[model samples]
Target: MGIRLMALALIPMLPHLPFGQSSLSTSPLGIGTVKWGRTEGLKHAPFSLPDDATLHQLLDAAEAAGINVLDSAPAYGLAESRLGSLLASRPNRFHVFTKAGESFSHGASFWDFSESAIRRSVENSLRLLRTDRLDAVTLHCPRHDLSVLSQSDAPAVLSSLKSEGKILLSGFSVMSLDAGLLAVPHFDYLMVAWNPGFLEHQPVIEAAALARKGILLKKVLSSGSFTSVSPAESLRAARNLPGNPVILAGTINPHHLRDNIAALT
Candidate 1:
């Protein structure tokens, strides 16, 4: 058979093998809290607060189902606060990853990628999460000015935080390969969206693997286009990748979270 046809035939069996599974082998699948405590009145959704009771239930469900990594951001309004309150008394095994760059305003959000902004955002995340430090803090997308992150200065800042024991890992989220490759050497992890509809990122995934950087797969559900592939299929595809370890799917529903966990199992 031709090489192209041979590779195509292997696609169906990719998920059955163990490839990207090791990255997450030590960590449970992640849950993104973007919608938690989010309101719709802002540019995207403003003045929104997720119901505390509902959020608590969701956290409980996630924990019960063995999800240990929870990702949030300051731009996510009250999400960090809610997560902090919910998991405060729980065990410390849960990994919380947050982002810097954007802040919430009156019915809108704005980006602030200045050094001051990065410092303040990390401080705020520590305060809101009720923790002394964070497990991971990503760049949370490219800056509004589109200025590339300075490798020398950026690493210094994140290294300073590491020295202070405030953050365990520093990474960035990028929509394009150029940004991803730019941040790779400076950061420890890279969160990128990878789904069938957005296969443009396949090369990025391969590059990250070659770089030995940890890869966090986001938007695996393609923003509710679950009909294209099941969660198991998504997990399988991620596992087949060279270095992808964790895949995060956002959902406020406990049942959906459980279903996602089932796919990994």
Candidate 2:
């Protein structure tokens, strides 16, 4: 039972909606803010971090081009805060997806999954992003910790947050097929690194479709691993997946961003 097949099975029960009707599906493009406001001293610089002014211009350009989703995380130093300030007045213009589970400390990263940690992360993200609620908050790639999404208490906490309208959905960032499979049944979204270099987990795409989970394709450029393939080729390969609609390719260059957006159109 592939994901597309599963969606077909449920189609009759679902309302007759237009294809690409959802805001997410309508645009196969999203902006990743990992380099938005962070200093290069913290992490290895894959590319130069864009300045605040440059980032603001990029956001404005993305919005003008009709890109709606902006992916950020609190772990990215001042990324959430910079994004919050940029989008404070135009929050409704774009869908904001952020993450918990990871935080920055002394030029390094750490992960925590205690219930208190999860709650605090969400609260801090809300404050830093200057938004009352997030479109989605994924558990930033935790190791050996499924309790956040599997334990009996986990559902209560997430459900409470959802019920209170603090978050539209919850999910986990997966690095392996097995992890993705485990998360499929429990999450509403799945953020996975998918690119030419790592195609073995393509099955997870089908799994996401089966679960009706939104698939956020990250590392589509493979972190500069496959520089030979043009951005258009990368975008085409990602879009060719039956159920993938949103792809996030991180780049600090506005010209590159425009080039990537051109591929989607």
Candidate 3:
């Protein structure tokens, strides 16, 4: 659903705007591609990766629907490679946001924030995403340990990539307010979880908004269960959480994608 610019208090990321109209601007909506490539590897996954035809149709739908950002990571099976290949045809269609630090092997996670590790991760992402540059690179750190990310050379590594014009935004996908606050000073964007049932990081999101950093919301639809909540209701609850947030809805179903685009405005 389209996001409105009304009463969006605390942070006027986008000040006054009308309701029922989706903004064509770049900040409000994004697609998370975890299920786009493979579903068997992640927790709570309910679908398998799509074939080429389905993925092509999905991208077509995204383009027709005016969706702008596509979020993916190396940990998301073949998501990066698929995107790299598929998106080459529509290079300017959507912005790409991916991550480093946390990786997967045998469906298990491994974390490394050392300078070299970060560098290798970024380089690999560049190759896999089929781009010399990335829109944003997040430190995929665990929530509880997020506050200590600065101890690693991650910020420096991302900064170097930014300096080389390879990254537009640098950030972290954090799990706690303390970690979110710590990330505010160092990142351009912060990915946090905010849904109807979870509000523990509301303050952290507000803090991020106060700092003028962009916020990307994960699990907005409650892992697609949305429980008994309708998309509009779920989106409303998300708006009530905190921050001038951006929704990252991961879906392979075209109808859901359309519904997701229309729920909030």
Question: Which has the greatest lDDT?
Answer: 3
Q: Write the per-residue lDDT of candidate 3 for residues 1-265, one digit (tens) a residue.
A: 3332221121212222211112223546578898886666555556667787777766766665566678898788889999999998897788788999888878688888888898899889999988888878888876555544757788888888889888777878987677777777777878888777777877768887777677788887778675767777877676655455777877888667656656654
- Candidate 2 per-residue lDDT, tens place, 104-209, comes to 7677778776678878989999998887888788788755545555653443566578888999777678866777788777777778778776787788787887
TM-score preference between candidates 1 and 2, better one? 2
Clash pairs (backbone) in predicted model 3: 1-260, 1-261, 1-262, 1-263, 2-265
Residue-wise C-alpha lDDT for candidate 1, range 89-146, written one tens digit per residue: 7858578889887777776777766667788889989998998988888877643222
lDDT of 1 at 123: 94
What shift in Å separates residue 125 of candidate 3 from its native position after superposition? Answer: 1.1
List candidate 1 segments past 4 Å from native.
Answer: 1-28, 41-50, 143-146, 150-155
Model 1: pairs clashing at backbone N, Cα or C within 3 Å:
20-239, 37-50, 39-45, 39-48, 40-45, 40-46, 41-46, 42-45, 42-46, 42-107
What residue pairs clash in candidate 2, if any at all?
Answer: 3-210
TM-score of each: 0.81, 0.84, 0.85
Q: RMSD to native for every prediction? A: 9.5, 9.3, 7.1
> Judged by TM-score, which candidate is best?
3
The best-first sequence of candidates by TM-score reads 3, 2, 1
